[model samples]
Target: MPSSSGQCTCLRPFLLGSLLMLGFLLLLFTYINPNMDSPSLGMYFRPAPSCSHWANQDNSTLESDNETHHTTVLIWKWPFQYKFDSDCGVFGVQKCYLTDDRSIYNKADGVFFHHLDIHLGDLPKIPRPCFQKWVWTNMESPDNVPRKPWLDDLFNLTCNYRLDANIPVPYGYLVPRNSEDPDFQLPTKDQLVCWIVSNWNRNLLRVQYYNRLKDHLQISSYGKAFGKPLSEEDNKKVVSSCKFYLAFENSVHKDYITEKLFRPMSLGSVPVVLGPPRDSYLRHIPGDSFIHVNDFASPKELADRLHHLSKNPEEYMRYFRWTKESKMTISWFGKEHACRTCGYIQKHRKSIEVLDSTASSQPPHGLLTASSRPPHGLLTASSRPPHGLLTASSRPPHGLLTASSRPPHGALKS
Candidate 1:
């Protein structure tokens, strides 16, 4: 009995010590992270994957006879399924494959997502590779797209119209064109001022501005609002005949300028603009290119200026002078966005690394391709960046992302 008691006494200290050590560890863990309810708390602070952290690897380089490395970008959702050419040929991006095959997710070097299609319920389900990158894009204004909390840290890049985006995709921009070419000529004008609106939103500032501007100016109206919807062909014919077109936009946002300004100028009509400030327009077009409503104290003043310009043929002709120096370039939205996605992935291959987003965030996912967005003008838009955009920063960024507004935001509809 004494021998058994001695053995039991020795075991008590050992067992008690083990229990105390475990209890101490439990207390330390509880102190380290007090809130056990929210697992996302940990994920919220998880460092986004950095380019330097990812060692250079062979990655998804497709081999060819010339040895050019091909980067595969899988589009997870086609924004309205507006696919164009199968590749990035339009953007002159060579060596990049834009595909919609989910089966190839494991092999793709990058995956692109349009904000409109991203439902928290339907995210990528496959295990993320260390080398793959995920891109988030939204081409809509904030007025249209409500912020999704999931947006943080989940994407490696952004593509959009905002200048700060990783890949800046403007609606359209001014570029040098041959004005001396005999084929180009300003159309003969007969009308005073014109406006064509299809999507009418009373809440828009352009609508309110138009209401007041019309009281002072003799303006011709077209499209659904005036119950005279012109076919696209007829619409251009009317705009070309008018001396001025009200290229008013639906929203006043930074870099939200769109085809409202570009189409009128293309049709040889001065665009009486109504979006962004005059300075924002000046960034893309020459100072004398378009008439901004914001420059005048009242609609009456803008009306008086227009009347004066109409009477002064020499002054009116100056508005078309940009034709002699630069041309407008607006791309079809879907294909160009995808092409650029592929090009960006290919170009920044060194920085390509998949985000280690929370495993619980995964949802059943698929792949895709799509398009939309454009550019602007003047007699010659002054020295704006060729595409009214700055490419990805020169720094070796963590990952490249771009944004573009979608349905909630109008490309030009006001």
Candidate 2:
């Protein structure tokens, strides 16, 4: 009813007020929830190894699991007699139970049998139930895993590091979120290149590369090979303080990356890798986070690249940009395996499956093995966390010690 000029004048304050409110909301959202980029699930992380089919049929007792049933996965033998807590909830999965007591094996829905613990003569006494499934659990690489033809029909499922397994467990993973800053303060560096290794086999490709690398640069070496025995504390201090860590694997194969890579990565030291090709690592981590030894034409060229990056802060920080942006997730070893197995059984409970008897029993992929025997004077894990037992088969012997994990007497914790 008013004139055009008068109407426009009155609407000015309302438009200004709306614009101010909208700006405030956008700023609030941007600050509170930073990463608007697409999730890094398939890129950085391997989809968290979820139960592909989903949960189980209805069980009225538990209100949890969305009216679905709970499942019990029994470990036939504790790996290396290194026991872990049976709580599946600790790994963020629900309505799942894990147990090692052989007495209750009859009631369990599924069972896990470790490869190393299975002695041929000593086998399960009881007859297998029609519904009960025996899962073959092995984390050994292709070569080290001894062929067991007898196991062809025994295992209905597998638990290993392979992406295609019923329960896939990689050494570490990256969360799908991004932070404004990773809160990673660089440790004081007293060394340039650090190689903490016990296994010193010249025949191994990694050791051969290390010898060539040392010819080009001065590497501050530690561990049994160098006669400088590092305590658990010093092991970490060395990695954190060094500008770069040589995460050379004792053996090379697909998906054989181990704690040799993870320890330095978690410790804020860039890893000069010699294990799998760069493409294999790119699946688990960002492309620029590590320097693959193969990328360089020669060891001298690789050493030159290291020197150039060391002197240049901008170039070197690219290797650590992921730590500054995303949260890192370490494999809580046995906990993840048990939880995933529990989830897998619940999903496939209605669908009875029998593995083809002709299939090879050797695990396709797993924690890598060193080429030869473990180095001398091996210091076993003095302390062990309840997550899982660390075995030589699952890691490069004394791969690298972690702050919390207590690998078994012969196993290295990372």
Which lDDT value does model 1 have at 155?
59
TM-score of 1: 0.70
How many clashes in each structure? 35, 3
TM-scores, in order shown? 0.70, 0.71
Model 1, span 1-414: residue lDDT tens: 569889998999999999999999999997876434235322211222333354433344322211343566788877765444555554666666677778666556677887767887777765555556677776666566555645444655567765645566666666555444344487988899999888788888888888998898788999988899886578879999999999887766776677778767766899999887888888778988898988899999999999999999999999988878666655457666666766666555445322222111122211111111111100111121122253323211221111232322333344
Assess candidate 2 and give its TM-score to the true structure: 0.71
lDDT of 1 at 17: 97
Q: Report the lDDT tens digits of candidate 2 across residue range 1-414.
A: 789999999999999999999999999997776333235311211111113322333333223432344476788887767778866654555667677767655556678887777876756766655445677766556556566655544555667665545566667666533344346787888789999878677788878888888998889999988899898788889999999999887666776677777768878899889887898888778888888988989999999999998899898887778865554556655666777677666655534444433122264533222222212111112221122322223322112225356335533321
Query: What is residue 94's positional error in candidate 2, in angstroms?
Result: 1.0
> Which candidate gets the maximum lDDT versus the true structure?
2
Per-model lDDT: 0.64, 0.64
Per-residue error at 298 for model 2, in Å?
Answer: 0.9
